[model samples]
Target: MEETKDVRLALYETIMNLVDAGIHAIDEEGRTMIYNQKMRDIERMDSREVLHKKLEDVFRFRSSEESTLLKALKTGEESHLVKQTYFNNKGREITSVNHTYPFYYKEKLMGAVEIAEDITKIERLIRRNHEPHTGYTFHHIIGKSKAVSEVIEFAKRAARTSSYVLIIGETGTGKELFAQSIHYESERSRGPFITQNCAALPDNLIESILFGTKKGAFTGAVDRAGLFEQADGGTLLLDEINALNIHLQAKLLRVLQEKKVKRIGGTQEKPVDVRVIATMNETPYEAIANHRLRKDLYYRLGVVTLLIPPLRDRLEDLPLLTRHFIQKYNTLFQMNVRGITPEVLTFFHSYRWPGNIRELEHIIEAAMNVMLDEDMIELRHLPMQYRQSGHYTPAAEKSPLLKDRLFEYEKQCILEALEANGSNISKAAEQLGLSRQSLQYRMKRLGI
Candidate 1:
């Protein structure tokens, strides 16, 4: 009997010590009886200090009646899967999801056991990793417009150095794509590429998130390396740099200038070898006029500025972009969408794409989803907004003078295609599905 009891005790201790969850239990009298190593680490307490102590003695609780373990012991009721935030004896706030259960033996209450899963680190990581779409590089950029070409060429040169790059463009112009391309092409390609939007988090938390945090800095803060440290030896893209308040921008400028960052509450500055790329959706001049961006910080970040033009400004790339999207959706949707009809192409060219490439992509994706059996996208397959736009007229509303209307429509299509293609006759002819000689003759007759 004695040997069996010893074996059971050893097994229980081994099992409790090996489990990752923090386990704490108290006797019916509320005295601590089983406080495992995991629990000690979670609570930041020593076994010697807490063993056999009353639940209200070792831990600081508002009241003994409010203690979870004691409440379970007193009422024999259970509290399962509850999230709690409370300070430990060391004044460190511990956020844990706990299950406090009252165990019974032979219809008598034995005690209460609380199993805690710490989720503090998980919460922090989720906040820091909120940014999506880090996979796009320069190769993902699909436009061959002069504007896009200039930006790409400048970005390629910028990638050769570790200098700070500023990408200025309207929203949906793929600024982050350019940033990632620069990182992948640069010496820091092998290093991590981390991104954080300045406007995503509030000003209070952005500082710690960008720099770092010391253990005793905040109520629940642990010693953590911020985004700068996380992206050390690599590239960090700060999207919407103008969104950051002026004070934070000053601190960011300091880090860029010194190549080092000091944690929010720490005195020592740690050296970081990081290349930063800041992007702004609005022009820096406008941002400065609005007082949303700092002048000094703008100058520091604009050492290499790459401007991405809006899709409306480079209408010539519309046909190319449309074809590329069709091919992309063909593979993704497992359909045989060959191309868009000329009517749809004309409509696309006439429409002012305010939302830029992203909007164009969405329009194409929607068209593909609606077109099931068709190989070509027609006006009806497009969104309602497109079908009702001035660029598209209903077939029923056609004028009685068919020849004149046809000639007028043909001239308009040729003119728009030529404009979109930057007046390149060959490219415009290809886009309009006409031979170069035929396009030239038509242009001569139409006086275009």
Candidate 2:
């Protein structure tokens, strides 16, 4: 009797614990049993009522026409993870993916247990990250690297809102790509996209360009649409925003706060609604310290900040990025560079890409124009600065001792694995066939 009672208590405890995991169970009869905190609030049903009532009637799945588990039982499949949407009794739409499998008693089919995970956030996130495009949309900024992908991921989230975005990175880190992509992905995609390089224009011309003037706003000014006026309903990319003079920063800040801009030498302040995306080669703080920009304006624009990584940090994507740049310039410059050799990739991986993507793009474009369409780019085709002499060959092979070499190899392997895992260390270590500690020690020793 005690043993039977203990088993019964175990089953009850399992149900109670499962409720904490936001899981739902449906039996062969299409009954709903929600046990998570979210369900409790959504359904407003007590645990006893949930467990005692027919799941379909209480949770609103009982009368459903399509039942996933019914098919699973019919097929006698071992298990399945299915994604589907359903509506509860309150007529609210719910999107969820369910991991389901059959439950058995003494090898007999008892029913099934379904663990459903809500994916509203995930779906919204995916829509934001991917752009439906004929070309490189904001979502096309793909990277297998965490540093790059995380920024892209954040950009998607930030795009769903109207907050000002400040993108900071070194030159050639693709800040403008993000800026453009953000505009194209947002609700204002159909609006005019205007871009102004605060650094490219002189102080005198800067104001004129940002805030258009009447026919005589400046010496060469025609009645024109300023960046703000052009970007009224869309986005204005303030590229190299830190290059603006402090005076310009103050003027820009007032426009940001007031949502209006005045033309140079013009009296009227044009009411404009533009999403501003500002990019800088360095931190806004540093820009402020140097008196290059205003601190208040910096804070106002940095509500959503993204830092783009230089190519050196994400060397794993070098081969892929090389091909992408090759394809791009392949069409642009009408070159026939097929691909880069593994030897070239090795050198590409080792060499620091100071100019980042621009340097890579430039190198590929230079090599492509000079090489055959079918020619595989070798070490010689790379920039002369990237070439290595024979003097270090012997030292390269032997200087780093076996342990150190092992450390180096281990670090590379760990990094690759980590990159593959989206910077999830536990997953990376599992993939490296090493304990997390072993991976950590080697990483620290290698300064990786």
Candidate 3:
């Protein structure tokens, strides 16, 4: 019993230490009980300095209620993905998104646990007030389908003028690529080209980041130019513009109309010669109907709208995309992979690529990793998850034949066995009551 308890404790400690997010828990008395390695990294604190110390001693918050853990402990509440900025014991400002929860034993409040994902680096990068650059151009985009060709033509036309352009497409459909292509193609190509994703920063911080902040605007505010000022005489790419709040959208519209911006706490308006290009992962009408976006702002921004087609809608270009990715990986991996098999191509067409072009590239990369001494990518070389997904059914088959069903069942059983045995062929074969060679043969036959 004692040995079992020791093993459990060790397992618990290992799991906590291995997690990506910071884990900080305190007792009801506000003394630290658990502070994992990730938490130490995020706060730049040593275990000796924090463990068994009072929460208030190791960190500084404006008020007790400002501390998510303390607030949860006192109010018995849970908060998720709440953005917080506070000072550590060493006076370093740290920003993070925290999920806090209260724990109880027999209806009595015991303590609180907080999982924090540090975003201090991201905040610092945005505040650096440096001009951003994009290497992608029209030549970088790879597609030959009519849908792709039409969008490219429209984007080039949008590039010729200084009008605002809005790009609409699903995630991973290369919306940003088009934005960059348009920027580089425009006459403002010589000036700065800055890009910001509206969904990345918190609401309270994004306003200051968009419009310049005065030194006395807030506690840590510095006199800095925002993206609009930074992109003067150039292009500003606001990716996922719909993610901005309605109030911010209105401000953006005003900036576009007047070609000027007022700092968050400044009196004077500064003129900016910036061509704005925005992108969204959702349809404009749906976003407006849901009140996530303003219709008037949409009209002002979408002076030249470009809708990029998803990969599934343009499967005719899959062959070109496949060849491009294959060549890319061949150079990166230093392998002489010729191309994918016709069977794999058939499966590609049948699969509904929800992730679009990005997913296809990833699939090809994964297959190449396991392709040993093979010039062509085969079905067995594909990722295990892709093979297991029902999307791998042949495009010609409306209903799976009996042979196909049996093959799928055998492949599933083998996959399960391999997974259970940590992908060890000998161990998996033993579990399946077969010799290793026999199992290998079966796996090859089933295209696992």
Candidate 4:
């Protein structure tokens, strides 16, 4: 029985030390019971300095209440993603986001445990600088299909206004690109532009990060501007806006309606001239129905909503998009790759591109890496998963008629010419070395 108990303790310690985040635990009397290696690295303290020592002796806080672990122990409550900054025994300052919980046995308090993720570097960088320039513009968007072209035109119009905009699309649909284009096009172009993923941080920390924090807002919080204040006089792109809990959404709506922000635990409201552009991966109506998004906030933000079409919905642009990615990889790889084979293009069109344009670009890049002296991307060059996914048709299984091949070739040529000419029938006809009427006839026969 003694040997089994020893082995269990060893296993628990091993697992605790292996965790990426710092793990620290203290008994009801506040003496340290567990201090894992990660905690040692985070606090720059040796185990000898921490283990069995009173929590107050190992770290200095403004008050006993400022220590989350101690607070949990005292209150018998759990706290998550609480930002805390303190000084270790070596007098070195450390900052971390922590989740602390109290443990009990037989209705009697035992101890408190804390898991801390070090964010000192991130906090310092954010304080030193606003986000880097948003390098994308409307010109960077590549597509010629009617669906994409219409959306781009609408986005250009939205770019001219300062009204809040909601962009809805699936993942990898370039919602940020549209958001940046609007910011650069508006009069606020010279001002700051900030982005925050709504789902990136926990509920407790996200509120402070978005609305700024006052010194006395919570334990260890310093007076700091949030993303909204940082983006004053410019734009704030909130990605995955639906990820925000409904309470925060209500706060956000209040901010939008009043054009002012109140810092956490602060009474004075600061007027901010910031335009918000929010994006969501799901439909707003569905999100509202499911209570993931507040209806009032949706109506407030959807003043000029833009729904970006998925890749599968606009497959007509596949060839043009593929060629663009080919040129991009060519410059990147310093190779003279031309284009993809018809069989590969057909396979790409048939497959449902769940990852959208990003997936297409990645596939092209992967195919180019595996190419060996082949100028064109063929079926053999595609990723193994794609080829074996049961969506690809082997050459032997496809129709092998010479007439059918000619028909597809001719149709593709006309489609490319029309795309190049912006669907101008006369220009496309001239480019195709045919009369306007003949091109129209072919288009009709080809069901284009």
Per-model lDDT: 0.81, 0.69, 0.85, 0.85
Ranking according to TM-score, highest score first: 4, 3, 1, 2
Residue pairs with colliding backbones in model 2 are 19-35, 31-55, 31-56, 32-55, 32-56, 56-62
TM-score of each: 0.62, 0.55, 0.64, 0.66
The best candidate by lDDT is: 4
Estimate the TM-score for candidate 3: 0.64
Off by over 4 Å in 3: 1-41, 49-119, 122-124, 127-134, 393-448
Off by over 4 Å in 4: 1-35, 40-117, 121-129, 392-448
Question: Scored by Cα lDDT, where does model 1 land?
Answer: 0.81
lDDT of 1 by residue, 1-448 (tens): 9999999999999999999998999988888889898888887888988889887776665432277787789899998666666666677766677789998989899899999888665455545564444566678888888878987988899989998898877788788889989998888888888888898878977888899889767654668788899888988889999999899998998898789999988999999999999998877766877999876576567667777887777788888888888888889999998888898777776776668888989999998889878999998898887776573443333223323433564577678888999999999877755568878988897888
Q: Tell me the tens digit of each residue's lDDT in model 2 across 53-132.
A: 55546443435444455555555464434556655556655656556677676887666666655654434433432333
Q: For residues 144-250, could you state the per-residue lDDT of candidate 4 as single tens digits?
A: 88888888999999888898999988898889999988898888899988888898878888898889988878756678888889999999999999999999999
How many backbone clashes does every candidate have? 1, 6, 0, 0
Global local distance difference test of model 2: 0.69
Measured with C-alpha atoms, the lDDT of residue 128 in candidate 1 is 51
Off by over 4 Å in 1: 1-136, 390-448
Per-residue accuracy of model 3 over 1-448 as CA lDDT, tens digit each: 9999999999999999999889999999999999999999999989999889998888898663389999999999999767788998899999988889998999999999999988798677675535456458998999888888999998998889998898988889999899889888889888887888899888877887788888767644557788899899988889899999899998988898788999987889999999999988877656876998776676567667787888877889899999999999999999999998998988899987879999999999999998889999999999998888676644443433323443555577679889999999999876765568878988897888
Candidate that beats the other on lDDT, 1 or 3, i.e. the better one? 3
